[model samples]
Target: MRGAHPRVVLGLHRSRYERRPLTAALDLGVRAIDTAFNYHGFTAHQRLAKVAGDLLPRLTLSTKVGYFPGPDGAPQHSLAPSRLLAALEQTNQALGRPPNLVFLHNPEVSLHAPADAAREALSQACEALADASRRGWCESWGIASWDPTPLPDLIDDTTPAPCVLMVRSGLLAGIGTLDAADELTARWRPSAVWGMSPFGGNAEDPVWKTVDPRMFLQEPTAEVSRIQAAFRVAYDLPSVRTVAVGTDNPAHLQEVLQALDRDTDTAMLLKYRKLLRERHAAINGSEARP
Candidate 1:
């Protein structure tokens, strides 16, 4: 079986945190919302609670931690157990309820310590989230890695496996990142895998104009917009079960949801991956020749 149809999550990374979008999402049957503690200047949770508290009960909420406000007002990534626990507490308080899932956001940014120390730090951080879940702070915990290349090596039998693993997805995702994400999935065996940044942060980027993503669809057609095809194909790029996408426009969100019914051409996806690998190897070989 091909498994259930992929789901779309309304990501708040670039959201205005307004009630209109939230209500539109619900109206479109998009009940899941993804946000990070550092979003909207670290006030996303509070703003969401204030603006759409009535609708929250109908949404499946997920949030991220790890980036804390620095002394200079800039954000700093940390893997300290204490900080993770504190952030989770604050997250619960700010939202007025526990989130359905809490992700340790972008821990790779802080894994510069030596291998052993880094492993220890990552384990402790994961344990902190797991512990918080045990205490009912959140329903579950996960890891959301923007760049997951460095994570697989640090994972061992003792490392706590997350319930979910969220990584970058779509055509813009590099070969190395796609491979690393697959490796991490193999090692951790999370219950679910999610893809994010299908448009690579901006759907209007000029690159979108040059590529015909419908080529990757099983039944390519001009009827489907390039953006919709790109969003549809993202689910197969890394084989994620859910994709978190950002858009304030209700029509755009609805168009994206329509993509879930379009089947991707798996053969085409495999060929593209092979081409990506060959091109990557050729570039590396050329650089080494000097």
Candidate 2:
């Protein structure tokens, strides 16, 4: 049996909704799972309940709400307080209990309004989730954003802070997005920060073959593959407390756990961040001059 590894969360974004993997995760002491309302064709929660309702109590469950089934049957994003609250109610029913944490999924997607209106819309949506938490709908609430650039500007005294703020992390994460995530973290001051999509949604991307991520480790080892190295370094790219990763293979989950034991080269990471900033600055400078 493996010891508990809380820092690694099993994300179900690309999961196959299999009971074996959920059981495998618990056996490996990976007790956290992240999912969203619209995943698996809006049936993820129901599927999970049917497949592994018994195992859920042993896991720290987190989910997101904001996307709903549209009139056309496709999922549509919204920040309406009533819609959000209704989804939270459905989430509790579908999972057979409240989630440990619930995030307002991708509010930026619907923030096409002017700055003031956008701020109001976001504040109301957050309040709905906050109220749900207080009412025992969930232990806590959070914000999970794929693009956090617009969020920092809209936050103010009236905006409720989330218990957790989840953003994309890893070698594939852009410098701009990383900087924005850091800024949002500072502004919101969440109790915890989480990183998602460390491989940018696909570990098999050709880009992984070109860059050797082991260089970011304090002491590179032949035992750690490039994928493991990349996953390990994601923790520091934007400085997150925990990361949400997805894999159905028990062997792959074990590989991720092994990467957690290796130390990251903070100095090397700082230098890389600096290089990225300089490159971004140069590109903007050239564009401004033209």
Best by TM-score: 2
What TM-scores do the predictions have? Answer: 0.95, 0.96
Model 2 Cα displacement at 186 (Å)?
Answer: 1.6
Q: What is the C-alpha lDDT of each candidate?
A: 0.91, 0.92
After superposition, candidate 1 runs with Cα above 4 Å error: 1-6, 286-290
Error of 2 at 55 (Å): 0.7
Candidate 1, 84: how far from true, in Å? Answer: 0.7
TM-score for predicted model 2 compared with the true structure = 0.96
How far out, in Å, is residue 92 in model 1?
Answer: 0.7
Q: State the lDDT at 43 in candidate 2.
A: 93
Residues 2-95 of candidate 1: C-alpha lDDT, one tens digit per residue? 2322398999998999999988888788889999999999999999999999999988999999999999989999999999999999999999
Displacement of the residue 31 alpha carbon in candidate 2, Å: 0.3
